[model samples]
Each structure stands twice: as structure tokens, then as C-alpha cells.
Target: MSLASREALASARERLDALADNTAVDAAKLAEELAAVTALLDREVSLRRVLTDPAQSGEAKAELARRLLAGQVGEECVELVGGMVRSRWSRSRDLVDAIEELASGADLIAAERAGDLDDVEDEVFRFGRIVASNPELRAALADKVADRRAKAELVRELLGGRANPVTERLVLRLVTAPRGRSLDGGLNALSKLAADRRNRMVAEVTSAVPLSDQQKQRLGEALATLYGRRVHLNLDVDPEIIGGIQVRIGDEVINGTIADRLAEASRRMAG
Candidate 1:
């Protein structure tokens, strides 16, 4: 995100946090309502463009948003969307993206309130792995021609009682309305959002075997020290790595595995 978008997101997050802090507000309903607004903005290009138009005054755009969303959504949802339009977005789509993020954040907050946030995060990661490992499943979820209702039912059947409710809802929403994102992309986004709820970065750690508890702690601490931010380890066992571990944080990879060394050596020899 650009500096402008980051500022906008931060401001929006403050509003969400305030809403979450209110004991009377229902977090789950807030999530669903925000998601509906996200869908509305996503489908209505002209409306999004108008809301994000630089030429229009922020207050004017906000009033328009409030008027459109007033009776359709809760007061909190109306205020939230109205606030979002009051900020400047770099692109029209950024507005929808921000709303989508808030929706995910709201769901995570619900899980946190239920003391199931960690479970939801792990479930999301595990579900991503399941989808990645099964080509048939991946194809089924990614099939554009398939009915979305059928796809959602398949998701419910696969995940129903097995995963946290928030996890199930997040995955179901992604599969039902991908918005041009792949299943992997959607899962990745959700995972990151889950981590962000705790103000941590996720490190995809691959090793030949599962790291011990002490080892996991040490690695997490080392990553935190290296990155200057709290790190959450998403451990993966890949025997192909031979030894050591490979850590990936976003685009940066710190490869210490024998497999990576050998691959580098092979490339150098070819060169």
C-alpha cells in the first residue's frame, strides 16, 4: 500500500476498533454488513468512482455514502462506509479493498472475542495447504463455470463442524465471491489479515521436519529480531529441503536449506 492508502486504512481501522470496543455492537453482524457494502461497491463501478473521485469534496462523498447505505445497513456500517469515502483513495478499487479488509478484520475481532482467533488463523493456513495439495479440490473451487451456491455448499461440507465458525465464514466468502482473485490469493490475504490482527508478520518456515517447541520459539524470536517486528511462524515440513530451514516473509526469502544451496551451486556451474 502507498502512504496514502496506509493512512486511510489506519484511520478506518481506528473506527473499526472503536466499534469493536462498544459492548452493545455485534461484531459478527458488523462483519457481514461491511462485507455486503464491499460487494455493493465492487459491483457498482460508477458508485465507487464517484465516492473516490478526487474532484468531489470528502464531506460530499461521505454524505452520499451515508444516504445510500443508511437504511440498507446498520448505523455503524453506514458510519464506517461514510468514513471510508471521506478519505482519499489512490484508485477507486482501493475503496473496495479497504472495505474487504475491514470485513476480514471484523471477523477476526469476533474470533478474538470468542478466544478462537489462533484457531481460526491455523485453520485458515491448514485450509490453504489442503487446497494447494489437492488439484481436484483446487480446480473445483477455481472453476468459474460452477455455481457459487454449489461451491459454497462444498465448502460447508468440507469445513462445517471441523473449523472455527469465523474460519468457515471467511473461506466461504472468498470461495463464493473471489472478485478475480484465485483461491490461493484469497487464502493468503486472509492469513495476512489474521496475522495483522495481532500486529505480527507471518513467516512461512519450511524444514525437513517439524521444529521442536523450543526451536519454534527461538526461530520466532530470531525473526522478530531480524525484522524488528513480532513474527508468527507458519511451519511447513518439506523433506525435499534436506536440512536446515527456509524462511519466507513476503517477497524476501532467507534460504539456509541444502536444497537451495545445491540449486544455487548448479546455477553457478551452468553460468
Candidate 2:
């Protein structure tokens, strides 16, 4: 990772960081751009075909990738990718990792400020489960049915009103694709982005804030009781937690913050 090519990733990451805060960045445009990138990648297979041509040297294959990226994607894409080509990265994967990384990075940059879309997660998962559970769903997506519209319509029926526009469109694309025959892969693809989107590592913490020895001990015991397993506490800092400290375990943030207590008191008064 500390190689010269890593420097290109750093540069690309910097470019991407500037765009991350804008929630309105167009997914449709990004998807179109990514599709073009995938096409370029698919075309790169020819470079390997000539790699071992005895008359050709290693430099030739590197030059091939450089030209392709340069011509199709312009200087910025070309140079960053060209850096990788010139570097002695292994050719065994045939540059599959490089392509995948770029696409994933692009998606992350586009989705960075977009808040969580739980409907996408639930609907995509449900669609996958339905496909797996029903023979007809699998058949519709499979090559057995040549009508693309019908296959796509089935996907629409399953996902309509239940998923976001992005999920609806993307699921339609995948269902019409060959791999959609496998419910496992469809779910995996949909969930893959969600898992990637979930940037934070879940820390199931149980703590008495500004934890003293006895409170910490008792809080760990309580967390174990609630979680049904022992948890390591991050020991939050809050004076408002009158008796017990707040525990932040992943998305299920146990926010027994002083603010919550105040809100509850206000609610009772209003009633």
C-alpha cells in the first residue's frame, strides 16, 4: 500500500473528498460513468492475450493499458491508472482489483453524504429472498424467458413502492442480467454497498460514563445481561447520565443522554 501507486490512490481520494459532502450528486450520472469504466475494463482483456508474445516485452503491455485509459478516460483517469501499470503490481488478477476499487471508490464518493436508506436494504433483501423462495421468480430472471420487459416488470412488481428510486432502477438492471439467476449473488451485490456504506465498525459498548471502578464493573455486568454476552465498554463521558452511563453499540446507539431524560420530563409535563 505504501508503493508509488498508493500515491495515486491518495490523489484520487483527495479529489473524491471534495465531492463527498454534496448529497445531491447525481447517482444516475455516476452510474453511467461507472458503466463506461466497466466497458473499458472489459476491453482490457486483450492486453493479457499479448503479454507472453515472445517478441513483445513487458513494456508493451504497460503501454497498451496506458493508451487505452488515456484515450477513453482522459489524462486524470489515465495517469492514475498509468501509475499502477508502470508499477510492478502483479498481473495475475488481470487488473480486476484495480477496476473494482475505482468503481467502489466512485460509488462511495457519490453516496458519502446521502443519509441511510433503510428501505433499499429491506426491499433488496426481501427481493432476493423471494427469488430464492420461488421457482417462477428465478425462471423469470433466467434465460428461459427471453422477454426482457417481463423479467424487468416482475422485479418492478416486487420492489415498487417498497424501495427507493435507486434501488428500484439498480435491481431492475441486475434482474435482467445473467447473474440475477442466483438469489444469493443478487442479495450479495445489493447488500455489498450497504455494508460498505456502513462505514463505522460497530462497537458494542457498555459503560458508566466517566467510569469509576465499581460503576464500570456493574455496567459491564448490565451490558452482558442486555446483550446476552460480555461487551467491552468505551466508557462515555456525560454528567447528565445520573445513574448509568450510555452504551453505544453500533447503529443501536443506547443514547441515555441527559437530553433524553430532559425530553422525557418535558413530555410528562405536557401530558
Candidate 3:
């Protein structure tokens, strides 16, 4: 996203956080309404362009959004979308993208309110791993020719009773309507969004053995200190590493495994 879009998205997120803070606002319902708006904007390219037109007055665009959304969605959603149109977007599509993000954010807020956010985060990560290991499933979910309802059902079938409802709904939404993102990309985005709810980073930790509670806590604390942000560990045991652990946060990797050291030594000898 461009700088303008980033600024716009940040402003939109603040608005959403404010709404989420209100106990009276139904986050899930807000999520659905925002999603509907996203779909509408996505389909109406000319309208999206007009709304984001730099030449147009912000207040006018906002009024247009409010009039269009008044009875179609809740007041909260109307206000949110109106606020979005009042801001400058780098591109018309960025406006739609921002609305979609708010939809997901609302769902995360709902999970947080229900005290199921942690479970939802873990479930999202596990589901991503499952998809990574299963090519057939990944292909099916990413299949554009497949019916959206079928993909939704597949997600529910796999996640129902096994994961948090928020996780299930999130996965279903992504699988059914990926918005041109790869499955992996979509899942990673969702995971990051979930983590962002608590202002934390997710560390993919692979160790030679499963870490104990104390070990996990200590590691999380250390990473948090290093990064200056709280870190959530998504752990995996890989005995093949022989010893130590490997931590991945975004594109950065910290490799401490015996296997990595041996490989480095072998390369040095070969040189």
C-alpha cells in the first residue's frame, strides 16, 4: 500500500477500535456489514473511483457514502464507511481493501470480547500449517472455478467443532473470496491481523523438542525485549535440527540449531 493508503488505514483502524471499545456495539454484526460494503465497493468500480477521486470534496463523498449506506447497514458501519470516504485513498482499490481489513478486525474484536482470541490465533496458525502440508486441500481452496459455497463448506467441515468459531469464519471468508491473494498469503495476512489485535508479533519457533511452559515463557519474554514488542510463539518440534531452535519473524530468521552450525562448518571446509 502507498503512504496515503497506510495513513488512511490507520485512521480507519482507530475508528474501528473506538467502536469495538463500546460494549453495546455488536462487533460480529459490524463485521458482516462492513464485509457487505466491501463487496459492494469491489463490484462497483466506477463508484469506488468516484468516491476516492482526489478532485472531489471529502465532505461530498462522505455524504454520498452516508446516503448510500444509511438503511443498507447499521449506523456504525455507515459512519465508518463515511469516514473512510472522507479520507484520501491512494487508489480506489485501497478503499475497498481498507473496508475488508476493518471487517476482519471487527471479527477479531468479537473473539477478544468472548475471550476466545488466543484460541482463534492458535487455530488460524494450525489451519495454515495444515493447508501447507496438504497440496490437494490448498488447491481446492484456491480453485477459482470451484463454487464459493463449496469452498465455504469445505472450510466449515474442516474447522467446525475443531477450532474457534471466529477462526472458522475467518478461514471461510478468505477461502471463499480471496481477493486475488494466494492461500498462503491470505492465511499469513489473517495471522498477522490476529496478532495485531493485541499489538504483538508472531514468532514461528521450531525446536529440537517441545519447549516446556517455562522455556516458552522465557523465550517469549526475551524476544519481546529484543523486538520492543510482545511476541507470541507458534511452536513446532523438529528433531531433525539435532539441537537448539530456529525462530522466524516475518523475513528475519534466527537459526541456533546444530544442523545449521554443521552446515556452516561444512561450507567453510569446502571453501
Candidate 4:
């Protein structure tokens, strides 16, 4: 996203957090409503263009959003979409993207309220890994020609009674309506959003073996101290690493694994 879209998204997130904090609001219902609105906007290019038109007054765009959504959606959703349309977007598509992200965030918040957020986050990550490791599963989910119903049923059969309801629903939505994203991309986005709910960054940590609870705690604390923010470790075990750990946070990687060290030493020797 460009700086403009990031700013707009941050502002929209703040409003979403405020809504989540409200005791009277039903976050799950709001999430569904927001998803519906996202679908509507995604399908209506002219409507999106008009709402995001810089020539139109923000108030006018917002009012139009409210009028269109008022009867079909709850007041909260109507107001939320109104507020989003009032913000400036880098492109009309960015507006739709922002709405989709907000809808996903709302669903995570609902899971958080139910004390199932951790489960949902882990489930999303695990599901991503599963899809990546299984070629047939990944192909089935990503197959554009397959029936949407079959894909949805495939999700249910795989995840039913095994994952949290929120996790299942989220994964299903992504697979059924990927819009132009790969399965891994969609899951990563959701995982990041879930981490944001706790104001934490996710560190993908790969080690030769599973870390003990104490080790995990110390590693998390050390990373948090280094980053000046809470860090959530998503551990992956790779025997190829030999020893030590490799940590990835976004584009930055801290490599301490024996494999990386050997490669570095080999390069130094050649130099």
C-alpha cells in the first residue's frame, strides 16, 4: 500500500477498535455486515469510483454510502462504511481493500471477545502451512474453475470440529472469494491482522527442534525487548537448520541457524 492508503487504513482501524470496544455492539454481526458491504463495493466499480472520487465532497460521499446501506445493514455498519468512504484513498480499489481488511479485523475482534483469538491465529497460520505443504489441497482451493460450493464444503470437511468457528469461517470466506489473492497471501493477511489485535508483531521462528516453554518465553521476551513491542513467535521446526534459530519479521531476517552460519563462514573464506 502507498503512504496514503496506509494512513487511511490506520484511521479506519482506529474507528474499528472503538467500535469493538463498545459493549452494546455485536462484533460478529458487524463483521458479517462489513463483509457484505465489501462484496457490494467490490462488484460495483462505478459506485466505488464515485465514493472515492476526490472531486466529490467527503460529506457527500459519506451521505450517499449511508443512504444506500441504511436499510440493508445495521446502523453501525452503515456508519462504519460511511466513515471509510469519507477518507481519501490512493485508488478506488484501495477503498475496497480497506473495507475487506476492516471486515477481517472485526471478525478477529469477535474471536478475541470470545477468548478464542489465539486459537484463531494459530489455526490460520497452521491452515496456511497445510495448504502450502499439500499440493492437491492448495490446487483444489485455488482452482478458479471449481465450484464454489465444493470448495466451501472441502473447507468444512477439513476444518470442521478441528478449528475455531471464527477460523473456519474466515478461511472459508478467503477460499470462496479470494478476489485476486493467493491462498497463502490471504492467510498471511489474516494472521497479521490477528497479531495486530494484540498490538504484537508476528515473528516466524524456525528451529531444529521445538523450543521448551521456558525457551519460548525467553525468546519472545528478548525479541520484544529488541523490537520495543510485543512479539508473538510462530514456531516452525526444520531439521535442516541443524541448530540455533532463524527469525523472520516481515522483510527483515535474523539468521542464527547453523545452516546460515555455515553459509556465511563459507562466503567469508571465499572472500
Best by TM-score: 3
Q: For model 2, how does the per-residue alpha-carbon lDDT over 185-239 read when each residue is reduced to its tens digit?
A: 6555555555445432222333334567886688667766787654544333445
**Which is the better candidate, 3 or 4, if ranked by lDDT?**
3
Q: What TM-scores do the predictions have?
A: 0.93, 0.49, 0.98, 0.96
Candidate 1 per-residue lDDT over residues 57-122, each given as its tens digit? 999999999889888989999999889899988889988999998999999999999999889988
lDDT of 4 by residue, 154-254 (tens): 99999999999899889988999899999999999899989989999999999999999999999999999999999988888899999999999988999
Q: Candidate 3, residue 206: CA error in Å?
A: 0.9
Deviating ranges (above 4 Å) for candidate 4:
269-271
**Backbone steric clashes in candidate 3, count:** 0
Question: Which is superior by lDDT, 1 or 4?
Answer: 1
Question: Candidate 3 regions off by >4 Å?
Answer: none
Whole-model lDDT, model 2:
0.53
Clashes of each: 0, 0, 0, 0
After aligning candidate 2 to the native by TM-score, how far in Å is the CA of 75 from where it should be?
A: 7.4
Q: Clashing residue pairs in candidate 4, if any?
A: none
Instruction: Show the colliding residue pairs in model 1.
Output: none
The number of clashing residue pairs in model 4 is 0
